[model samples]
Target: MDTSRARRGSDFARLSRRVAEAGLLERRPGYYAIRIGLVGALFAGSWAVFAAVGDSWWQLPVAVLLAVAFAQVTLLAHDLAHGQICRSRRTARTAGLLVGNLAVGLSYGWWMDKHTRHHANPNHEEHDPDVAPDILLWSRGQAETARGLPRLIGRHQAWLFFPLLTLEGVNLKVSSFRALRRPSLKNRAAEALLLVGHVVAYLGALFAVLPPAKALAVLVVHQACYGVYLGCTFAPNHKGMPVLTAQDELDFLRRQVLTSRNVSGGRLLDVALGGLNHQIEHHLFPGMPSVNLRRAKPIVRDYCRSLGVDYVECGLLASWGQALRHLHDVGQPLRAARRA
Candidate 1:
């Protein structure tokens, strides 16, 4: 047993006990049952209506609605991936594969690996894949070395954020297929098959029902909206929170709290964001059911205050503003160099 690991997670362990005592960590079977049924019904219902509406421009609006359904199903898959609703690892993996790959055309294995790293190190520049300076620079160090398209885009990334998100849906699918090349991916063959199956079924339906041109247009709209809606759901989580480096040594509790921020909103925003507005709690307790995060917020906040740690939470728009400001500021150096 690694005593060092135990020591590092001690604070988190105590906090976990408190949360457990409050029953926050317990799975909400009733909540998840209804939630899953409703999302599944909505997903099936949307597709049925799309088929019923057949061969018309009116289907464009239906495409948008289906995008919402897609995002929601993806969110549910996220919950399953975290074992939020599943008790056994086997069950979680099976469910994740079905929900993510078969239904949504996303690779469960690929997303699981990426998301695990993120939860393990939320804003760490080196360890967290989420902050790894892909197209947009997350830190000045990355920005300095960025070139070509990334450099061009990083300079105005804040303004381009939403527009860029329109491409993320395509990017995600492409990335999933690409991840299959890696030997580290588990059950790669199954993941690949399910994803390909999703493509065949999805495209087949589009072309079968509508004219070729209209089919292409509807496909574009669905994917674009899916990307935008998915991006919008996640953008506010930790974009402006503190970025950590190797030197910033901290225990699990502080690590999770300091690097995360919460968005305060009404029930509508809460559901839309899929309980991600309570990102702080979600990070600290990854397996905690989404519905319980809100209830755990105050408890965690007061605990943080006692420990002299800052708990960040703000209104929805403010959170986005802070994130955009960070993106703009990171690009300031490049803009300055451009001017000179």
Candidate 2:
């Protein structure tokens, strides 16, 4: 039952040799320039919705819908920071920080640092530092063993995944503040100022322009929409990939592609994910503009075949199930020694 497909090729070896000669894929500034105009349009449109909601009969529905789109824009900010949507590092970080803090209420510096780590060591147990304290492993003879409440939560992540994703704003605030506090006094002062400034600015706008209750309602709606948008877009990738040991670059690249399957055939999914659904190609060339991902798919598939690595590409429904299965798998126990 397992031997009929064409034998896999040494696509990986060819890819590696090509990479050695051509270097890692880079982002093109043209992608960033065009997207900058698009982001501006999105930002303006969201603001128009915000303004119109205050006066129109369609207030509630429009607010809810636009809130969802605003959250998607937050993801755009993230991609920008990674230089995925943009080519210039300075432009990426500047745009990410501005939009992240203002539109999504997250600390840009903190998120960049943490997310950078996640990209460097996705699914790693020790080196990645992104895994929650309780993720389980099924290596060696301990494949079927269960752990504790952490195990339970990992196994049944669907219930908890929503809450965690929704509270991302709060999580970012707390974690970023904590990280800020750990640095020098000067840095701590700057962080405090930024925190206070963020709050004052938003609260001032709410109180000055809208009724207190209405302002609170708007904030609640905005955050909820943002959370839903985040989880749906991100969980599809790397949730089911192999957990890491040491931080080896090649191994990390392999896990990213092999574990992160793509969701196909939907324009909405591609737009919503900011084109991240082309996960394999994206992993291979993180800095490349996402518009090219679809075009690069066959190139990536060919490369993977030559390398004898599995390129897991699937449709949305199957990808979602795979993500759930990953959650279930995470409920087991770790085989590696705990880091001291």
Candidate 3:
């Protein structure tokens, strides 16, 4: 191995030992129970309001609340995928299916496949699907090579990023159904059935009590809110961080830490993000419970500093600014090309 890789391995070993000795890996059942209870109550209560209000103008706010509830559930599904919520993989998979497919109209299987790859090779130009070189180019090279409508979007992606997020909820639902059509996905029949049931129930409930126009309006509001909420939570995690080339080889610790950006805030931000604000720590330990990530942050930060590794953390607003700046910077070549 190269000297850098060897050194990183030693540092990672030391950090892992320190974290384990501190008992940071121990599961927090009580914390998860409280989270589950509160999130479940919020989801149920929101739906209750939607049902009770029926066709009133009050339904608009209720729709936004329902979107929040759905976003929270999706975060729980993320935890389940990491095996943080349950010891047994089977149980965790079951929970993931319920939250992702039945509750949130997403496919746990598709997410696991995509998210696993991202965790394994985050920010890799060739390997990470999250930063795939298409309309939203993460690298200047991609922006320069852009053509047609993708080129137009690339020229102004920074400005369009947040507005486009409002449609991400629909994109996710569409992507889930599209994934089910693949021949390679396991348990395809079961996943398809669950998704169909979710759509039927979700739309059925909306149309059952309200007039057609009211139902349409509520659907639009709920989906838009859900999409933007999810996008905001995830965008900060890696958007402003480094992008790796396919040829680059870093040790696990360096690979994860260098490409992840943490947002600094209090408990409210933590809850809203589902503990993702500690992105550096979470990337270093994907299987660790979300509740434990905050506790683990200081340890990981100090360890990275000791090794001279850059550990990126900033306020939420600053992080978003950095992300937008990065997007704009990458798009500059495309903008110039268009102007020329």
Candidate 4:
């Protein structure tokens, strides 16, 4: 067992050296600077557009644009939390709080803690919160044992996935606030302060510029689209992939590769998914800059092929189909029980 564990460790060590030698792990400060500027400008410009278009129906389109901007800002925050854009922990955390808590209204520290655990144990049924039974079931066992909402709604979860995503925007905010009450979250007071400030600032701006009805409508539109945007970006990464358990023993390289599914496309897809389309590469090298994931993909894929590990990459839409199929199949027990 010791020898096997050593060999397993060496596999990831070897892969790491290859990635570093290729310089794919290097920080892209220049790329991130440009991205931040563009994203920040868009976010500010959207609100300016809203204020300028007050009391008009055109604010609806502005709301959609704002939703896209919010998702982009969240993506940048994700990169910062991983130290992909900057290596300084303090700088990253501070920036994360600004864009995440203040701008995006999501808690930076809470998300970082949760996301770190996720990267450490992606798709692990017991260890990964992402896969653990919650509103929907990810495994047959979860569906079989589910009670209340999970049991009641899971049978048709596949059809409800996207619709449920529409509420994810509000869910993120609500979850963030709820998480702040936990003592585990660092800088809880600061996090709570920024979050509250965002709410006040956001609402103040909306209502200040438009009528009550228009302001509320813009809020609804922005949040709904933002939720769906985030859900779609994340859904294709691991939803249909293999679900690991405590019993499964695998090396670091194999563990990350097996559980992640990459979505294939060109630059447009890269921009749309915030470079998450290269999910496998991103998972394997969390610190790698978002701009570098695409460059690292072929390298990682070829290496996986050499090692005889399954390398999964499919078109964007096909990946969603695979995820939905998995969701539908997991609910088979409940569906069957209903029929019986």
Full ranking by lDDT: 4, 1, 3, 2
> What residue pairs clash in candidate 1, if any at all?
none
TM-score of 4: 0.98
**Tens-digit lDDT track of model 1 for 227-266:** 9998877888889889899999888898999989899988
Error of 3 at 262 (Å): 0.5
Candidate with better TM-score, 2 vs 3: 3
In model 4, where do residues sit more than 4 Å from their true spots? 1-5
- What's each prediction's clash count? 0, 8, 0, 0
User: 140 in model 2: Cα distance from truth in Å?
Assistant: 12
Worst 10 residues of 1 by lDDT: 4-13
RMSD of each: 2.4, 6.7, 1.2, 1.1
Could you arrange the candidates by TM-score from highest to lowest? 4, 3, 1, 2
Error of 1 at 166 (Å): 0.5
- The Cα error of candidate 4 at residue 208, in Å, is 1.9
Question: Any idea what lDDT model 1 has?
Answer: 0.91
Model 3, 1-340: lDDT tens digits are: 5795676678878998998898888888898999999999999999998888877878889999999999999999999998888899988888888888999999999999999999999999888999986558888867767777667888889999998898999999999999988998877887898999999999999999788988899999999999999999999899968899967878889999999999999999999999999999888888888988999999999989988899999999999999999999999988777678
